[model samples]
Target chain A: MPKIVDHDQRRSEIVEAFLSVVARKGLPAATSRAIAAELGVGTGALWHYFDGFDAVTAAAYKRVTERTNERIAGASTGLRGLAAVDAMMHEILPLAKETLDEAQVVVGFWGRLAANETLSAAEADVSDMWGGRLRDHLHEAVDDGDLASGTPVDGIVDLLLSISVGQQVHAVMATPLLDPARQLALIEQCLSPWRRTPRQPGETVTR
Target chain B: MPKIVDHDQRRSEIVEAFLSVVARKGLPAATSRAIAAELGVGTGALWHYFDGFDAVTAAAYKRVTERTNERIAGASTGLRGLAAVDAMMHEILPLAKETLDEAQVVVGFWGRLAANETLSAAEADVSDMWGGRLRDHLHEAVDDGDLASGTPVDGIVDLLLSISVGQQVHAVMATPLLDPARQLALIEQCLSPWRRTPRQPGETVTR
Candidate 1:
């Protein structure tokens, strides 16, 4: 009998190859032939798992998105206030090499998806999902009286999401603010102004 | 004498065409042929002013960087503190349609430039130039005692730049924080925590 291959695992491996090439090279270099060559597989082999380049690209992006969400969600477990949000933001920012490479791929994919509707929808869905998490966290803060009552939960949610995305760009561009330690401090400072009480001299907000 | 076209003006026009193509289509689509077609000029006309595609792209990117710097300089004439930073950040973020388009192009170009030494150096120069202005403003804030004394100017500068770039990505992804107005408010709130004043009625420091 022929050995059974885990379709999900195989698909994930292909996606990883897709992401690596796209991140190292720009989106254009992430062509089907290039991906196949990178993977040392026949060009037709990719189609066996994915519909085509678009499908593969979409899947690769989805793979990144899912992994990111999972990490953020895990970090956010039982956390509240700015700590939870910061945790989520840190998870999204491009600091670690893997996350940084993932961010490059994500931005490139966003550009490529702009003109392609299917990819655009997938992009939108992922963004919306992330936004929803941010919104939920903001709402939670509001409920706990950590945030001001009149502050628009929706707006704050958006603000956090925007800052998170901006941080990724900063990271890839090697902008001064891309320093992980500084980013953490600034994020903490940024959240400070919105809090009801001044952060005590030594209180770890996360605790 | 044969009619002499203003070479600089002609190049500027070509740069504008390149920007349009880059903003509308991805950079890959902004080939010399496409730009010439957009300008209603023969394909050879571009080569008359530029060495080739890379020259046009670099020039176009420089044009954008100049335009953005001009806007920030224009907007923040005599502004200070949170207000100065606000204007600078707003100018960089994808607030309006024109800036939004520029953000997309800038981001795309930066990614492509990452691996190319010449391109990356040029891009880094633009970023440093921008950061210098920011550092100057920050130093001014510190001098005025508007910001806390112990604050790290370089760190803050990085944070500010990071937030702006992150915001651009946020806007492009259609995250909730699309509105510049709300984002500005959040930024103001974020900066408040770092101010020397203690426990203002509305302020809460959630460390």
Candidate 2:
């Protein structure tokens, strides 16, 4: 009988090898040869599944986004209101070595995204998905009465994402100032105004 | 008489050339030859002030930081408290095309920093300087009764810096969702709780 070949599994294995190469030696050095060496295979093996280095890198990026989405979904499952938001935010924070590695890879991609349109679109897609999920939770909070009516969900979501991305950079750089606990506290503080009674007359409504 | 060449000015010119090259081409493409061509000079002309490509890039990075610091200082020269913070934050936001270029270059450097310790330290130094200035403004706000006495200025500064860095990325990526005005409003919103009157017992204190 012919040997069974799971194409999807093979592609995933190649992506994992790409990620390991990236993690060990930044994105610039993660050439086809390095990735192949990572997988204990010849460079030609990668081309069997990918067109070239770019194709493999793109696949690895997709894997990163999918894995992140899965984690966010798992954390936010069966939770609601601020609790759900908190869970989702925590899922993105680099609190552990594994998550830190993920954050490092994502941050590394920012520079390439600046010059590479293909990678930029891929990144934007992931960002949009994350933003959408966060927006849904903010709407849920409003519906649950945890957030006051007229809360600017869009702006709040933007602020939340900005803070999270910034924290990821600090975490990878090992900035001593913003640890996991402090990061959580900052997020909570940003959310506090919305939890208050509806904006009073003459108060500034941040949109 | 021999022609007079100002070493400091020459170095500055070379740095500018390096930046222009980087802006036009991505970092990887901004080779010594490219920079020299940008200056309308031979590649050896750069050797007068710097050792090689690495030296030129390092000098360019320093120039970026110094220019950013100078702008922040100029903006916050006579301002204080939340106003000072606002001015400083505004200086970093990509409200103008020039500032947008600066943000683009900074974002581009992040990928290199991920793999290069030298670049990473330079970035951290600039961040520390920026954070320290922000902390000073927050302290002033507390001293002036703009913020409650027990406010966590350190954490607030961290949050502010994080938001600013995140905004830089968005500004570079042309994340259409956050225009300059909206970015400023978001910063103000993040700082709003501190601007509120001191909380009494049973009141929520966000810091």
Candidate 3:
């Protein structure tokens, strides 16, 4: 049991080293050689830990997903309904420097995800996890009279989840689509129609 | 002039072959060796025509963009306003086999684009091009009395453009977000609040 725990610890350290390389340099620069260098080990050491580059990318993808989930947990603490939804989305949307860097790292792995089913299959369906949480927060909003009855919560969940996944690549593309004000507006657009008070455009919702 | 024409012609043929390999197999299968085999040539022939795999991918990305633009023109011919928006989006949304395959091809290149600035720089900005078109179409819809007088046109334009680009990768993810109905619903979700004749939950906007 101790040996297995040590093995897991080593894998986590390697994945962290990979992310640090991606953060300082860009993704292409985060080669096995670079990751090994970051850990003060030989490139051959990475192959001993991971199957290949694809395995490292998949591990990094999962690491980023877990980090975002942790942030969401922190952001939504003691909040519920539209307020909670707004806070949770803010964590995922790449608005700040940390999340923007996370977007860059995750978006780089997506092409590999598309190409390799074995690697991608090992990762869970993000839509289900994020969609499930967003759906719950929406229902909480409805219960609190924050959103109207018959608010099409399911459709809104789908809409927001799509935006969550979509914006990662948009931020990487460095388009106006990644603009914070514009993204906040889209999030508001989703909730505005359902809000009881129906806040006006250009008005800040939570933060 | 003829020699220059032939060089361009040859590059186009190689790019087309790359697409063929991608369409029949998947993105990862569309390798230099596979592309050369698809054309019954050696992999060295491919490098002679293009600088490298990154160059081949950039060319293929540009080719796909041109092809999609051509489809948009053909689909939207003699159409305007919301009708044209629906048609143009239908062509881009990866709802069909051709577009789904195109999505696989383009999503694969995004990783390279993020990695290589020289390669990414050669491509045009998709947001500006697509956003500009969607913006005009939304204005036309408003002018024709199809949408509300005080519709937040710019916000809706940004929302729809984000979805259009975002859904390409989403579809490649093969989640429910890729569901044609769900995607079309997301589009309708954007237009619904602004429509003069608001669409009901189950109602179809257009064929």
- Tell the DockQ for candidate 1: 0.29
Cα error, residue A188 of model 3, in Å, equals 0.9
lDDT of 3 at A165: 75
Clashes of each: 12, 0, 0
lDDT of 1 by residue, B1-207 (tens): 123558888899999988888678755577788889999989997898988665675677688888988998898887876567767777777778888777666655654443233554556465567678888877777788878877667755655566666665555556556666766655554455456664356552221
**Model 1 chain B worst lDDT window (10 residues):** B198-207
- Model 2 clash number: 0
Best candidate (score: DockQ): 3
Kindly report the docking quality category of candidate 3: medium
At residue A3, give the lDDT of candidate 1. 29
lDDT (10s digit) by residue, model 1, range A36-107? 898898899888888777677667778888888899879888897556777787788776877877766666
Q: Which stretches of candidate 3 lie over 4 Å from their true place?
A: A200-207, B200-207
Give me the overall lDDT of model 3.
Answer: 0.84
Candidate 2 regions with alpha-carbon error over 4 angstroms:
A1-10, A22-31, A44-55, A148-151, A196-207, B1-11, B22-31, B44-55, B148-152, B197-207
Alpha-carbon RMSD, each predicted model: 5.9, 7.1, 1.7
lDDT of 3 by residue, B22-92 (tens): 88898878889999998899899888789999899889989999999999999889888999889888888
Interface RMSD of each: 3.8, 2.5, 1.5
